[model samples]
Target: MSKQNFVIGLTFVIGLIVGGLAIAVWPAPPLSTPAGHALSLRVPKNRQLLDIAISPDHSLLAYTAITDGRTRLFLRPLNRFEATEVTGSIGAAQPFFSPDGTSIGFFSNGFLKTTSLYSDGATPITICAVPGTPAGAAWRADGLIVFAGPGATGLREVAATGGTPVMLTTIDQDAGETSHGWPSIINDRFLLFTVGKHGYDPRLTLLDLETKDTRPLLLADGGGFVVTPSTLVFARRGELFAHHLNSKTLKATTPKNPF
Candidate 1:
């Protein structure tokens, strides 16, 4: 991989797990070095967490930090030495970058909003009105944003420019899934998300965007996942793992000593 691609892939794979706590980014199981370890990223002034994200170009890092009982968004240039406040207000969480990485989408005060990295103030995109909270979200290459629906209503999608989010799939209550969230776009046609109750083990579900069909992908136990060009990384039972994936089908293949 080129230096730029390496940075983007690394950020996506690691940022998936930086919610609500201080954490370290590990090499994708396949990329483990001889020492089988990776360097740590120290987040500054981090008290409580909401979410974190990286731009497509791997130039910027955005995250939410709680301090003085108030939540705010922070941004830092990966090549720079310090972080700075991006959003002057509280309530922003679940930050995601636009496809081109020029703007950021987030959930604040029960609504979906976006703010330009070069401008000021967040603009409301949609009134999701999700009860409790929306579980997870992702931005598509074709300008669509997919997010977890209110309660157990499965997943929903809306235009990146803003509109009513339409239901993307139906939830199967009989499957023992309490709700679905943490959606990550696997490719142009597929998405991966988490489904389960708070105390129960959560599994990853793959959604076919074209057919709206859903199937179990893996047991994540309510953790996060990411799909890179040559591997699939996921978290389960507090451990992170990577497995070989058929590039075309995006399905797991036999394990190869990852990396």
Candidate 2:
């Protein structure tokens, strides 16, 4: 099968702490080893972790860290204790894995770029220029990437290889909507994102990729992800919450509960 046709099957967990750096991975229950035990990774006193993402198969991790006054991306296998820096990933932030876990996508120097994880002397490939710092991005199985760009007011779609981006969603200024960001691809035709304004009020929203329609799912303070086909997870006030999601209708089937 083609790489673009690959589907990611692992759960995505993100941990971000401002001013300090600590990374913990808590695998879901019922594994060969006991669950809920966090595997913490620490950085040196001089370096600081900024953002992180897990590979699709959960065997590797990609994170952005400040080292030598430059923000760069690093890769760490779960079985290893140290992470190696990606050479051409200076200024990289918000790193994410490709669907097949062979490359990583990140924002650097006002552009979205990708780099191979295993190639020798591979340089970062520039996908497209973004207006401002991106809020978040997700790679879809169909070879398209959706990201929130340019003040995070709307969503934009660009090919994974490289191309000009087209607007996907328009913010409803009259409805007090200020920005739309943190996109998670549910499938080829639907997306989960967050809608926010000046204050901390954020709503989990669902967008139809085919029709360009949107629907509010719940009140969430951060990005939401479909952990499973029937479950959605998000955060509110630093606490995680889960909901029974009807993926077909893109609606929450149950009330929010602590995750």
Best by lDDT: 2
lDDT of 1: 0.67
Q: Distance (Å) between predicted and true CA of 35, model 1?
A: 15
Best by TM-score: 2
C-alpha TM-scores of all predictions: 0.78, 0.83
lDDT tens digits by residue: candidate 2, 143-166: 888888857378888999999998
Quality of model 2 by C-alpha lDDT:
0.74
Local accuracy by lDDT, each model? 0.67, 0.74
Model 1: ten consecutive residues of lowest lDDT: 30-39
Candidate 1 regions off by >4 Å? 1-13, 16-49, 120-128, 197-200, 254-259
Off by over 4 Å in 2: 1-38, 198-200, 254-259
What's the true lDDT of residue 228 in model 2? Answer: 60
